[model samples]
Target: MQRLLPQHVRAATFDRRRWRGLDPEQVYAYLDRLADELERLTRDLCTANTEGERIRQALRQWQSRHTDCRHTQVAPNSRWHR
Candidate 1:
């Protein structure tokens, strides 16, 4: 799975060389927008992670319930059993 950077950090650090010429007010506004975007992204990521975990747990449970181990045992007339 691909990992995503938090939006605020990505925005702040985006094109750092070009950002050097930006005025203070613009910088502050960018940071504010970044912060909001980051918060929303974080919440979404958490929800997705939780849902993934739940799906994984459910798959595990279903697999365990349906798996058959009887085929692994020796047959009644098998020489190895004697």
Candidate 2:
């Protein structure tokens, strides 16, 4: 099945010029549900992006500290000193 995008949801139209056309109320309700789903998805995406950035920053800080320890020859446990 093809997935519907936000634009597609917004642009949906039902035939109303015929006696057998779809009910307008039902169509509008479905559109409302689609909008709600789109909003929820957007929020989830933003939360995921924020968490990913946080992890990247933590990794960078750890790498910097590790590099500093390697270059300084004076790590806290100094196995060479023992």
Candidate 3:
């Protein structure tokens, strides 16, 4: 599902009732804070995703380079085999 962007939150409009309606100032202030948090979270998520892809690529390259050794057996006398 698509997520809401900071602009969406800032541009949101709510219907006001004749009586007992929500305070527009409070709603706008809260929306502003929510938008700010969403923007920060979006940035953080992007950074994390990019870093994760980098790590995945590095892991794939390392695995390809080590593919031959993956099937090799070590002697019983080898410290690593022990």
Candidate 4:
């Protein structure tokens, strides 16, 4: 429901319960907090996905280039070799 529920719907919906059930206000508060976190995490995930795609594209472009292969592929005994 997190993905399907709109922010307005989340804000407006209320749970039905018996006399001994949990407090409606508490449930609403908790749901509101959860909804806020869900929104934040969704945005973060999209940003991370976008950045990952950009990095992948850059790596592909770099791999396609053929100039200066020696510097990029140094020998095992080179200064930058591990």
TM per model? 0.56, 0.64, 0.84, 0.65
For model 1, how does the per-residue alpha-carbon lDDT over 1-82 read when each residue is reduced to its tens digit?
A: 6555565354554343664565756777777777778789889989999999999999999889867754578888999786
The per-prediction tally of clashing pairs is 0, 0, 0, 0
Best by TM-score: 3
Cα lDDT tens digits for candidate 3, 8-81: 99999998878988998899999999999999999999999999999999999999999999799999999998
Q: Which lDDT tens digits does candidate 4 get at residues 33-66? A: 8778878877898899999999999998897784
Clashing pairs in 2: none
The window of 10 residues in a row where model 4 has the poorest summed lDDT is: 1-10
Task: Point out the worst 10-residue segment of candidate 1 by lDDT.
Answer: 7-16
Q: Order of candidates by TM-score, top first? A: 3, 4, 2, 1
Which segments of model 1 are wrong by more than 4 Å?
1-21, 69-82
Tell me the lDDT of candidate 4.
0.77
RMSD to native, candidate 2: 4.6
Ranking by lDDT: 3, 2, 4, 1
Pairwise TM-score winner, candidates 1 and 4: 4
lDDT by residue (45-66, candidate 2, tens digit) is 8899999999999999999879
